[model samples]
Target: MSSVASQVILHPNVSKSLKVLGTNLGRDKLYRAVQYFARFLAWYLVSRGYKVQGARWNALKSHLALARKLMRLGKPIEHLQAALRAAQIAAEPGEQITTICRQLGYFGYLTYDTLVWANAIKFFNFKPSTAEKVSKNANRLWLAGILFSITHGLLKAGRLANDVRKLQNAHLTEKGQDVDRDAKLGNLYNARDATRHQFIIDLLDVWIPASNLGFTNLNDGVLGIFGLITSLMAFRQQWLAVNGK
Candidate 1:
């Protein structure tokens, strides 16, 4: 009923984190402002009925098993692409072109699972399937490929010259900028561009920025993981956006 209860209800991970944080997620009273925002979000989502009590309990158990498997046995995520594909098929917008009102009344795509799965599927389409855990090497290569794709796109555009003259790409110099580079989707190359990619989510948790230049740390490995994801995503995006194939 309370706002705090709402957040915990909706975001089971936060609910768990609150438990872990020493009855308040181990955060300090000094972070009053941050706590308020956190409380507000929890309450808001709760009020909006975002939490799934049944799913939360089941998911937490599955997630714990997976974590233990990863840590102790070192088992990798298997059939990841297939799982992604299936999940995508389940959650994605139907091929049918139904009315917006019909879509709204269904509340089908509005849930968190649908939202995350949709992007995860998209990422899977663009990124290679992996047998092992996500690694820096893969991270770098994925980042590289992302940059390459974006840059290749840019080189197709025409207006990229005068502005990009300063940002000579490591790969572009060898290949030269194309017409794509000449276009004006400059914000796509921004530092905050990291926000664009699919996140590494586990169970009820979605990775969020923990390292605070501005935002509160939420979720497990919230700050460090998302920061890495964002940084790599941004770097790759910029590299691709600026460079040409």
Candidate 2:
């Protein structure tokens, strides 16, 4: 498809951001960062005693698009937003009490995933189906890069470097949490070809929820997620040191 056809009408608020980032960063990666930043901001606002508004609205729109595409909900954004807002009001008097509200955990997760994926698609200029697999592929490369560079990067993660593939299929339950009680995402290591350099860049992203029981703040959630990443990196380093991969 032509670039124009694939190009999206990102929010007015985001146009300037793209302009600012133009030509200075890699393709798709820069936008992917923006999408993540957007999610972090939404969580940040909620933590700072503010309600999620525009971000939430656009978030719903993005997720709604996905749902419609996949034949899930098949509805417009306004209908869902109105319903969500009313439900939010009916759920709690304020942020102080939301537990009483009747809401599904999957809804919250879906919203977060949808918004992230939407921004990612818009920013990366890729379809959702394609972007969905990018991380997994990139992570595989990331793990390989670590092994190649160190030859023994697995011991640090408390596993052999060759076993890195396990993480790709592992779940929170399969791999018990560290002392922190925070679980890790599906896979942290990925091997991706950087859109800019064309040289491969190995990287990882470990997603953590804001709440343990569904009431934690975003910052803590991110920290917890990254904390796991830190361990993985550290372990990789240690394995390399010991094994000299």
Candidate 3:
């Protein structure tokens, strides 16, 4: 029994999962998954006339959201640092501009979101109107950040496509460079795949802030599913990164 127990504990998959859960990003993703699930479940229950159950799920979602906000208290500075780093790195003008803008947008969103969290916890005694305004601004900034991310992804995809075309054209004439050409193509393909994955995540996530800012009439159920999908996608990426897979 001890041998079996040790084997289970030492399993690679189990170890990797434990490593994933050990990180803040991993834990936050897991919580976000559950939170959005609760949101969708609450909406579904209420639509089916299960008022009491729906309320319970709604409470769960709210609590989890507050917890996530607390977890992200220091993230604004991280975005600011990223923006600073991007400014120093040499890249195409468009890439640098979009990256800096995206980071700044996220910095703004997280800064205002901190205020929202403080108000919720009574740490700050803002008026109802002020709180609402803060929340709206946070969502707007989040939406802007997501839009910038999408634009970055599109720009990257276009550049990758052009590189791919050039590589293919070079392959025809560069007979002795087959190995080098293939290696470069492989790297580019991997980058393209990663960019596409992030693009999809950004696309799904945009609707969440858009709905919050009243740009769309999407309901909680729809928004919940979108959040859930993007959370899982991000979670998977984080998991792979942690495991070096």
Could you say which candidate leads in lDDT? 3
What would the per-residue lDDT of candidate 1 be over residues 1-245, giving only the tens digit for each residue? Answer: 69988876779555544443442212222132232333334444455676564345335434432332223221122223333443444321321111222222222212322323333445333233331223223233333333333333333222334334444452445443644444433643541233223222211112231111123345323333333344444334333443422
Which candidate, 2 or 3, would have the higher TM-score against the true structure? Answer: 3
Top candidate by TM-score: 3
Model 1 TM-score relative to the real fold:
0.18
Instruction: Report lDDT (CA) for all predictions.
Output: 0.33, 0.37, 0.95
lDDT, residue 212, candidate 1: 19
For model 1, where is the 10-residue window of minimal lDDT? 202-211
Question: Taking the tens digit of each residue's C-alpha lDDT, what string does model 2 give over 7-77?
Answer: 65565435644454343222233333334444555556666666756358337435543443333222234
Please give the lDDT score at residue 93 for candidate 2.
Answer: 36
How close to the true structure is residue 239 of candidate 1, measured as C-alpha lDDT?
A: 39
Judged by whole-model lDDT over C-alpha atoms, candidate 2 comes out at 0.37
Q: Write the per-residue lDDT of candidate 3 for residues 1-245, one digit (tens) a residue.
A: 99999999999899899999999999999999999999999999999999999999999999999999999999999999999999999998887899999999999999999999999999999999999999999999999999999999999999999999899887355566888888999999999999999999999999999999888999999989998999999999999999987
